[model samples]
Target: MTTAFDTAARPAAVPGDTLVLAGRPLRDHAVLEETSRYAEDVWVLTPAWLRADQKTLRLDFTLVPPALVDVAKPLFLALLAQDTPPGELPLAIDSIRTYFGCARRFLWWVHGRDRTLRELDGEDLDDYHREITALRLSGGATRCNRRAVRMFWAYRNVLPDHLGQDPLRRSLWQAWARVHRRAGGENLTDRIPEQVVAPLLSWAMRWVDDFADDVLAARAERDRHRGPAARGP
Candidate 1:
C-alpha cells in the first residue's frame, strides 16, 4: 500500500480526522532529493492517530513537483482545489500529481534542460512516447503517461498565442486523439462497453469504501480500549 510521507515531511493542518501538512520545497526534503527535480512541493496527510506519537508515526505525502507546479499551479488549483468535491481531493490530487509527474519526467528525458511548455514541438512528444514504448512500460503505465502528456498539451494550448502560432501543436493533438480513440491494449477502458465497466467500477468502489470504514472503525475501537488513563493527561 502507498502510505503517506513517501517524500517530504512537515507539519500542517488538523482538519478533523485528517492532518494536512504544508508543502515543503523538494530541496529541503532529503527523502525526495533524487526525485525532487520532478516535484515542487509535498503535502502529507494522515489519520490523527498516526501522528499522535512521533516516534511511531509513518507518513505518506502527496508530491507536487516543480514540473507540475512551475507552469500550471493555477490550473491545478482550479481543478483540484476548487472543483473537487469534499472527501475526494486526495483522489483528484493523486491523479493530477501522477499525470504531471509522468509528463515532467518524459520532457526531462527528451530535453535534459529547463524549457517552457510553449517551446516544445510535436517531435519532442513523439520521441518521448516512442522511448517510453521502447522501454516496455506496463500497458497501464504507458497509457497513464500518454494521457498525462495529452492533458499537459491540452492545458498548455489554452495559453494565449500558444497554439495559434504553432501548427505542429495541432498535429500532435490530432495524433494523440487518433491514438486515444483506437482500439488497443493501451486503451482498455475504450474497449470495454460502459455496461460492463459500470458494475465493475461500482463493485470496486464499494469494496474500497467498506475497507476504509472497517479500518476507521478498528482505529476508533483501539482508542476506546485505551481508556482515559492509558491515553494520558
Candidate 2:
C-alpha cells in the first residue's frame, strides 16, 4: 500500500526544510511547518535537537486494516505537524509514538466493524471509552487512550476526517477521574537504591570539592596557551 499526502490541499515539502527550527526549544510557541514528506507509515525524527535514541516514531498503517489507513495516516500526520496557536507544541518522538499507539488501538477497533472516522458518532466514542474502561489498563494508559480520542476533535480542522463532536464533553467522561484516578498522589517512579545513590553522591562531592581547583587551573592554562582569541569577545 503506497502512502502520499494530498499535495493539492497541503503544501509540498522543500528539500532541507526542518519540522522545527534548529535550537528552538521544544514545547515553545514556535509554529511547526507542514511537510508533505512525512506522509509515510514510519517517520524517523532526525532533527539535531532530538537525542539519537528518541529518533524513530513508526505509524505503520499496515498494522491496521487497509480501509482505515487513508483517513488514519492524514490524521496522525496532522497531529504530528500541529504546533500552531490553539494547537499544542509539536510532540517529542516518544510522545508521538505513544499517541500513535493509543490511536492505533481505536483504529483497529473501528476497522473490526468495517467503519471509518467519518461515520463515527458520539455513541461510537462512548462505546470506545467504555471498551477502554473495561480493559483495566493503568490510570496513565487509560488517560492516554482517551486523550488520543480527544485529539481527533481537538485538531478537527486540520484532519481530513475527524470526530464531529467533542468526546471529552460527553457526560460519560465526567466520572473519568473517579474511575481511573490513582490514589494517594503518589509518585509512580521507582526510587534509586541507597547503595547506588550513596556512591553517586560521594563521587559528585569529590568532583566538586577535591578536583574543582585542578579542573579550573587546567582550563586557565589551556586558555592562556590559546591566547585572546580563545577567550572570545
The TM-score obtained by model 2 is 0.60
Against the hidden true structure, what lDDT does model 2 obtain? Answer: 0.64
The parts of candidate 1 lying over 4 Å away from their true place are 1-40, 45-68, 82-93, 110-113, 157-233
> TM-score of every model?
0.40, 0.60
Task: Give the per-residue Cα lDDT of candidate 2 at 66.
Answer: 73
Q: Give the per-residue lDDT digits (tens) of candidate 2, residues 65-153.
A: 67766556656565555543264455655667788788888878887777667688888888998999999998889988998887766
Candidate 2 error regions (>4 Å): 1-36, 46-49, 52-56, 84-90, 178-233
lDDT of each: 0.45, 0.64
Looking at candidate 1, the ten consecutive residues that score lowest on lDDT are 157-166
User: What is residue 169's positional error in candidate 1, in angstroms?
Assistant: 7.0
